[model samples]
Target chain A: MKKTALLIIAVLGILLLRAAEDLPFWGDPQSPASVHLSDYYLEESYEETSVPNIVTSVLADYRGYDTMFETVVIFCAGITVLIVLRRTHRRRAKVISPRPERPGADIILQTAARLLVPMMQLFALYVVAHGHHSPGGGFQGGVILGSSLILLALSYDIQMALHRFKEKLVLLFSAGGVLLYAAIGLACLFLGRNFLAYGAWAALLGISEPEAHSHGMLGVEIGVAITVLCIMFSLYIDLASGGDLDEGL
Target chain B: MEDLLAYIISRYNYWAAIILLLIGLYGMIAKNNLLKKVIGMTIFQAAIILFYVSIGDKRGATIPILAHGHDGAHQAVEAAAYANPLPHVLMLTAIVVGVSTLGVALAILQKIYRVHGTIEEDEILETIDQ
Candidate 1:
């Protein structure tokens, strides 16, 4: 009954938000947002970017400012993960022998890891590259990619996975992604355009505006996806592998 | 009737996405297991991706491939133009944002698990109170 009531409220809330479009209190269709967003982008997008994907053009170029901030937010998250999960040398010394492997852990996980890891990574890369033409993007691709490694850890041993990727390497991968994104922005600044204005650098690269935007967006998205994927695996490692497992064995 | 049904079917993506999102939310808020909560969060985030992807799709539109045509002059007779590729592009960033947030959340959960020796919310709280 409570769940039903909550669902009713949620439905009503959605309806109410939708109804706000019909209200006269809002500005006219000819209002600034409508003029700029719906009309201006509709007409000018093709000319500016030559890309059929208006959302991509807007996100990668027109509103590159917002995307830069989004990248920074992810950078902040990476830092936070390090802060939370970093182990002290002293603590490492104390955690001397590893604990025993949990009963049935080996039998359950070994076969699956041997079979699933490569296939999952392939799917993740596909999602990342085809993002412009399809529904999958850096984030989805990153998670799928990250989860592939996480699955290996879960099915095999957390300690084994940690040794493979290591905390330091994951941290570096996360930092590298943020740096690449910022470096692109700085590159635009050096070219006399605003941050991420790859179109301005077209003269150097000899590419058209649309192609430049596509390349730039791909670069940044790659950075974002890589950072996301590495950080995700790092989190799994932090959660599952901490403390000495062999001591219990 | 057929047209109406077709319209609804085409729009079913949003409904399914919303349902998945709700289920995820329920799992996140109600489940005691930390792993279950993380799984719930993944499902919820996946729903958002589905919603964003569906928004990019237009009825009767083909994939946004640059065909052998210029400004519809030499366009194929059967070509229905292209669906907006922007939403798919935007979703790429959103997917990254979702994973980053999920990573942070999982790290926190891991820390909590470390401190409590158990991942269940009740068990963690009991350990904390003591």
Candidate 2:
């Protein structure tokens, strides 16, 4: 069986090599991917949406629907983990007690995390808010924010993290984020524009069209950040504890 | 022969991506353990992400973020002067999707382990075959 698998991989490798011959060279300026519609997205995105970051403009404005569904997909995965793994009983004793019950492992990690969590969370918010001007957006910020909580779980204890962020609240935030994104689209629609057409709301907000789009993109990104942050922590706690939500590493 | 070497060097990014993919494929197929198969899936997704990001690269270009002006205002952006942003945007979702799938797959594996008492594929199949 292993030999059969090896043979298959070899054949696939050769096929891919053949296909690679037709692909453009490394960093070819005229490569199809660069010269095509991406040029328009890069050139016009800022003027259209007032967001200087091309990636964020393209992601949250041009391809807004795709990103909204992507957020939903991640949310679905988190819910599946919750449904599949969540248990009524604790599976094992806590890995590290919050009060440094174990000597060698706890002291350093706890101290570092104590210093880092606030800084990490502050940076995550900065990343989310600064996406319009720089290289970060809701997804990156959400992951970083989630990691701060995960660090809390790892350093102190799952119980301590859970104490601050209850499981029910996390799940609610995940659902609420997705709902907020949908609400923005619906609100745009009710304002007599196409779904997810941010310019429509400009009249209501008394802002210019481009400024409205920028604000809309920011709102959607905040929704995405909220969903991603909670879901990341939810997945970690559930997976780490074998669905029991207690005594996680 | 020289042209062939240049061609190979130029398009070598795909070669690395394909190699990573094959490694994941072998892990998935040859490894009987469910946990290893899930790990293979993660690697396979990662390789695809690498491939897409490589496609977005441009020679003599800056990062996708636009640079601010000397006078503290937006400059007339040169498209070719920046790496393609589309692929990076798409792959961001791809990466999040990859993490989501891994989380769900591991959760399913946990359930399978709970039911079958072992995570080895052949053993689970043998038990079912009885």
Candidate 3:
């Protein structure tokens, strides 16, 4: 079976190589990808959104519907893990470990994490906030934020992290993140505008139309960061400890 | 052979993606372990992402962040000045989705292990047959 698989792979590789012959050369300026809506996005993003980062403007403003659904997808994934793993009627065994067992074992890692976690969270916030003019956005920033919490779990243990972030609180924050995003949209609608029409806030925020778009993008990015941070940490706690929220590796 | 080499040189990214796809495909087809297959699936997914990103590349272009001058001078914006941002945006979301999927997959695998006591495909099949 392994030999047959090897043969199949070779054949497939050759076939793909032939197909590659048809693709445009790397970095071709006139390639269909760059010729399509990308040029428009590149040209008009700043004028429309007052944000320097074309990618963030496109992701958060132009294609917002896609982002909204993706947020829902992550939320659903977190909830799925909760449903599948959490032991509600566990007459089995609890995986609890209250004491530190040995405080000095991971002294180096603990100290390093203590030093690094704050900086990581700060950088994550920067990435989220400065996404307008840089190569980052809420998704990248949220992952970094989530990793800091995961690092906190790894350095000390799950219980230490859980002390600050209760499951109930995490759930609320996770749900609330999505709610904040929807609320912004609904607010726009209430003001006699379309859902997520951030220009509606131009008058309220006392900013120009383009500036309002920037502010709106910032708001949505914050909402995305909150959801991603909560969901990622919640998912990690569940997956690492099999939903027990106790002693985890 | 020289023509093929030239073509390969010009489109190396696609060729590399194909090689990665092959490696991932082999792992999925030949491996008996479920976890290995999951890793293979990840590799396959990564190859696809690589292809999309490579397709979006533009020679001599800066990052997707538009250049700004604070002096209030209206410089003409050129499309070729920056790399295509669409793929970057799409792939960013894709990466997040990929991570979410991987987490769910690992969680499901844990459940499968707890229930089946093993994570080998043939072993699970045998148990089911018995």
Candidate 4:
């Protein structure tokens, strides 16, 4: 009864709040939002840094400082996952598998995995590569890749999936991605520019003028995508591994 | 009045996203079950993604591609007509962040479940006290 009353009151409060705000509920053709962010990119962004892909420009150049921290956060997660999932050499015997197989899950799963895994992996690669031009990108592509493994785990047993690809590799890849990003930043520092400065790389790589910025940004975007993908995989392993119970260390 | 209704109907995605977000928040605050909390978290994250996608919308814009026209030069279009890729870019990062945080929370919840054997917040508290 109290829950019902609270729910009603909450609904009323929400409605009142919506009524009070004069926010545009629909897409207004004349609104400030209709302007393509590209205009800002073409005019201001190019002058500041000459990257062609504005998203990459913003991520790698304009806001690379934030991105450094974002990379660090992902690294923190990878470390945490490692810490939580780490198994001591002797304690490997105590690591219990979650579910015991009943009957013919093996034959059925083998047939399905044979057909599905290749197609999913191909799609993920397409998403990663075509990200600069389309609605998809490294993060989305990475999740798709990570979730494909999840599809495997649900269909097959966890032991089979773990055997196919170790979590240690995923953690290593994730850490490597972050290290690559920092290395780029450090490289920029060596070249006498700010951390993650693309201009410095352009000069070092002998990339001239406008194209230099584009290539530099692309490199960083690759870094971002890799980190995002590995982090997503790490997250999946953490969640789907039944809370890392009995994994010593 | 008819036009007003049409406008509202046309942009139902944003409305739905906002509604979902509110509903998720309400559930998060009101529900006592840890499972329900996770459900709310998913709902909220998905709603936020919807909101971000809506922000990327431009009425008649195509994907911002620098494809060549018949002349083999970059086809120029009105700047106002291109979708804002910034929101999508930011949202992509946010989605990954959301998943990671949820993974950590769910991991901790598993530990809690193991220790207490009940997923209800109130029940756990009661058990702890006793």
TM-score against native, each model: 0.67, 0.93, 0.93, 0.81
Q: Which digits, one per residue and each the tens of the lDDT, describe model 3 over residues B1-130?
A: 9998876667888988998999899999999998998899899989999999998899899888888976534465799989998998898899898888888998898777766778998888888898
Cα lDDT, model 4, residue B37: 83
Candidate 2's C-alpha runs over 4 A off are A90-105, B1-5, B69-75
Worst 10 residues of 1 chain A by lDDT: A24-33
- Give the lDDT of residue A165 in candidate 2: 96
Best by lDDT: 2
Cα lDDT tens digits for candidate 2, B1-130 = 9998987778788889999999999999999999999899889888999899998999999988877653536667889899999999999988987898899999999888877778999899998999
> Which residue pairs collide, candidate 2?
A85-A243
Tens-place lDDT digits, model 3, residues A1-249: 899999999899888988888889888989988998999998888888888889999999999878988888888898888888777537335433233344544889989999999999999999999988887888889889999999999888889998978888989998888888888888889988888889999999898998898998899999999889998998899888766777666
For residues A20-87, write the lDDT of model 1, one tens digit per residue: 33422221233232333334554555556664455555665677677767777777776777678667
- Score candidate 3 by DockQ: 0.68
Which digits, one per residue and each the tens of the lDDT, describe model 2 over residues A69-134? Answer: 999999999999988988774543433223224334578889999999999999999999998998
**How many angstroms is residue B91 displaced in model 3 relative to the true structure, after the best TM-score fit?**
0.6
Candidate 4, DockQ to 2 decimals?
0.39
Clashes of 2: 1
How many pairs of residues collide in model 4?
A: 0
Q: Which docking class does model 1 fall in?
A: acceptable
